[model samples]
Target: MPSPRNWREIPARYRLEAARCRGCGKVVYPARRACPACRGQEFEKTMLSWKGKVVTSTVVQVAPTEFQMEAPYAVAIVETPEGARLMTQVVDCDPGAVQPGMEVALVFRLIRREGHGGILCYGFKAVPAA
Candidate 1:
């Protein structure tokens, strides 16, 4: 990601900071100006739980150029206890082993490096909870 884009997402990507719409009590990640549910402009900042359960998952057999080396990895939509869902890579286990309702803990990890500049991007990856 570009520096500007990456920097703007540090709160959500690094701290799991999110916004809760005051009008409808809806939560959204990456804190937007308006709520998708109610178009409410008023919001309060909130932090998401580090733990969640996999809602759904898929194995990527063919990967994009940036992620080719990690092909056949598992990606899932994990729903935190607060009811906020985010798509993340499920790591530290066999990709095919990831399943719906599986408990996972988010851990900080290197996401990817930008081309040429090698700017390191860090984000959360889900690992099976013991």
Candidate 2:
């Protein structure tokens, strides 16, 4: 259920694809043409690990219209083993239970339905690591 502009991002969204800067070794999510840290143009495609730890978390009591049904969910910045941090919703547990330093695993799940037609959108969510 992604927008037309987001259709091109399916690879990164579904597979955790990232671009690593050859000059600075910085990893940028969703891929990029240039490195934000070093301003370097040379990059290599990399895949992020599914395992990570929550660097920060927040409970969302209010959400966008598209996600109204899922209000009061936990959202967090999860840092992967490679040091790539990405924002994702924390699911499959109590929202208030999410905390910084909590171990989590990236999971593929439904994000939301787009528009009135109910086009389904799939992406990654974080769950408490077993």
Candidate 3:
């Protein structure tokens, strides 16, 4: 059986489902409900590269009630060479020093609590690329 963390991010981790617009060839993250580029309804599922560059970022000082203890986490909008952008949290670094255009590699991380059974909800997070 897959761990609770792996079960939740199955689409991203296993299938890597994303949308590639049939009209404009723009890759949309998470296989959007609608294409943002050409506003077309037609799409083809595509997988994303595990590498990307930070476009912009910020450190969240105030987190949600569930994530209150995880405050000061770093988040960023990253652009991949395949023309897809991802909004993900940056890890393995000083949250205060995250910068635009920094190269990052994809990694699965514990995002939050899942249940009373010590379950960890995992999702993709970015770390500095070596």
Candidate with the greatest lDDT versus the true structure: 1
Structure candidate 2, residue pairs in collision = none
lDDT of 3 by residue, 1-74 (tens): 34664665578654456789999999988776678878888998788888899999999999887678878899
Runs with alpha carbons beyond 4 Å of true place in candidate 2: none
- TM-score of predicted structure 3: 0.84
Per-residue accuracy of model 2 over 1-130 as CA lDDT, tens digit each: 4488668878888999988999999988867787888999999999999989999999999998877889899999999987888999999899999999999999999887777788888889999999
Q: 10-126, model 1: which lDDT tens digit per residue?
A: 989999998889999988877888889999999999999999999999999999899999988999999999778899999999999999999999999999998688888999999
Q: Local distance difference test, per candidate?
A: 0.93, 0.90, 0.82
Count of residue pairs whose backbone atoms collide, per candidate: 0, 0, 0
lDDT of 1 at 96: 98
State, as a TM-score between 0 and 1, how close model 2 is to the true structure.
0.93
Q: Candidate 1: where are CA atoms >4 Å away? A: none
TM-scores for the candidates: 0.94, 0.93, 0.84
Q: Model 3, 4: alpha-carbon shift in Å?
A: 14
Q: Give the per-residue Cα lDDT of candidate 3 at 121.
A: 64
